[model samples]
Target: MFQPDIEIIAHTPNPEKVCTAAVKQTYKKMHAKELIKNTSEEEVEKLLTNIAKLGHFSTLEHACFTIAFKDVSVLFEQFLIEHRLASYSAKSRRYVDFSEAGFVIPDYFEDKPEMEEKYRKCMLYLFNSYKNLLELGIAKEDARFVLPYSFKSSIIATMNLRELIHFLYNSIYGHGKEFSEIRKVGGMLLNKMKKLCPTVLRYFDILEHKGNASILASTYESSKSEGVELLWHTPSPDKSIAIAALIKSTNLPTALLKDIKQEEMERIIQSVVRSRRPRELEQVNFTFRINNVTLAILTHITRHRIHSPLIPSLASIEKSSSYVIPKGIKENKEALKIYREAFDRCMEFYRYLKSKNVPKDILAYALQSGNFITIITTMNARELYHFFRLRTCLRAQKEVRNIANNMLYLVRNVAPLTFKNAGPSCYFYGYCTEGKMKCNRFKEVVEHYKAWHLSPTKIPGL
Candidate 1:
């Protein structure tokens, strides 16, 4: 059995004091040496309390916490690393021989003996196979392809107080509560943080809504999604709002936007967006819901830190009995049979463990890498352009490239003027960024996008 733990290995001494000093320096324009030496703890606390009360969190960035977690699974890594502003050092599956690593078991099946037996047998088989493959001279990276997400891994993560607070609030109060794993880890981190700086964390308690927790549980709990689906929300129904916002940087009067004709508005948007000035395209925000993507693909997409993603437990993937088979594998009969058999065996073990009442957390390791999961994420027009440029390239992973292509279609359908010039880097920049890795089919890619943009009712060819 694996026990997960989080230890605050290092943190700024007098964090509140440091933050308060920074606040005072910014507000009073005090000399750093003088401020650091003379600012009393009481004065710092008073200022920090006010800053929290006023919802000013940026000053907290001056203070950081470095935490180390042991016996946790890579399944939790996606959540921790999603905070792009933070720094991380985690145990890598590619380099580590996880033969000795323990596995996590969820509390739900603690009392179920039948389920426990099934789980033990399955895990034993998988681990034995992994060790055998090693003896057979298989690379750790390739052998690890069969390892489960439940395998215990360690990480030393560092985040500024601002991101820490955000992580805590979102975990305990918002969408984070939906996943039991995140809630457990969040509770542990919060307890540790409160001991370090009760004054700062107290702000969250003060801001809590009357029934926020109950509301989130009722709304988000028990939800599961499967297979590749792309959904968009809150698209600008009228392009004028985006056009006006884009021109707002020019300090133009509000009345001027109304006076501008549709054609002129179109011209302005196309010109600025096509110019590749992403800062200018930041005027509009786009939110997308992506479902049924593989866990591997989620890892790839989450690298775009500027975006926000909400993903369910990788554990829930078992219930879906779903997995993605790549095109090349599917095209060959023997290969497809072998791929399906592997997942089938994995699923059989997964269910055996469940029936025996094995801990649900440990069961996640039985999930195949190709298991499907969901992500509801958002990116502004600027980041969208960047995402499209990178992910839509031929050199990108096949799964994410498909996602990017769909995202392009969705955004273009709603805000054609804003995304008229958005696509792969080669198409957007008039040249491939991949250099020697270039697909050299830039012309064909451009023609495909052109045709897609011209159609009002046809699906784009991938």
Candidate 2:
């Protein structure tokens, strides 16, 4: 009995006029303010039609929309966030007690009463288990591991007209059309767009399918390895960063970069890094293949928006038996037993659903937040430095901190000078930025990292 509640909270006023004015400013000598005031409604509509025909959509970015979604599954939330050109504020599972949070029952169950009853029982059991973990003094963050992917969550997403159109195209006609929930939401948003900016929709054809699912289908492959593996990195990363920096800082010609000595390159890298303007670091990149990452931690890593992470489809079945158990739950015998039993029950129900031949998309709702997945991600040196600074901190979640520390260790081996002083904010800045929430283990952290820097191969425990 789950229904998504979607509302357009706000949108750019006079959206067509805004887009039309933006288009006109490019060709006309008149300022945007004057052009908007002078442009007639009919003229705006005609101009937008012409612009759409010409395949110029950049002006569409001038119009923005803020939409709020409630009573939607976390699966849909994940799909929504995959549209990178948007802003999102989602309800936090860590802080929220989802014991009473409802879950989605896919349309596939409507025809089969017996299957629906079994599915309901499984969902209730998972929720009860989650609540029991809380009653046993487990933190909400740790207890959320037992929650299923179908659990209802809320999100407020904002996107410009161009991105919104792209999002709707995907949801309605692209790869997202395979999912019923996405199609429903896309239809609702399209209706709103029709009313708000009919002129824009008239020229924009939704039937022109933009998805490349067929072309990309053959490239899919299962992950064959585990843990963090540095799949690839830019060759001579330190030199790449140093060269980019020298090009910006010195008056020396680009031709002389080949003549520069290693000592001079190292000096330039040090100067650029210490200057605190690390844009040059973006010249180097690293790609990592991390396996067995929990859904909870996946959310944590994806929030760092500057990187590109390729995750499996939400409908895809997790083949690994691996799942995360927080230290708090593992240390308590009763909590550990409850946590393990919850996963076992969920998996048992999953197998039952699979035996019934339910589509993987519908069956995927049975997956626990603790379920593991493999992801491939690429990050530039600058973003990696930022990622390491925040995630390597003692304050960071243990699983993420471990991954961050490992990645830092790996990169330091190849690009030592670029990440020479990389680590937690305290270790990098010589002071904790968390104020009252600080870990107060400054000396321990500094000494550990200092040892780590000197012996790049050795990752000493803090």
* lDDT (CA) per prediction: 0.70, 0.84
Leading candidate by TM-score: 2
TM-score for each predicted model, relative to the true structure: 0.75, 0.94
lDDT for 435 (candidate 1) = 80
TM-score for predicted model 2 compared with the true structure: 0.94
Q: 396-437, model 1: which lDDT tens digit per residue? A: 776788888878777777876777777888777777788887
After superposition on all CA atoms, how large is the RMSD of candidate 1? 5.0
Residue pairs with clashing backbones, model 1: 106-361, 114-356, 115-355, 115-356, 115-357, 116-356, 148-365, 149-365, 227-292
Alpha-carbon shift of residue 147 in model 2 (angstroms): 0.8
Per-model clash counts, in order, read: 9, 0
Please report, as a residue range, the 10-residue window in candidate 2 with the lowest summed lDDT.
213-222
lDDT of 2 at 268: 89
Model 2 lDDT at residue 176: 76
- Candidate 1 — which residues are off by over 4 angstroms? 3-14, 26-29, 45-58, 66-71, 81-117, 124-147, 153-157, 169-238, 245-256, 259-263, 274-280, 308-310, 313-318, 331-338, 353-366, 434-462
Candidate 1's displacement at residue 147, Å, is 4.6
Error of 2 at 174 (Å): 2.4
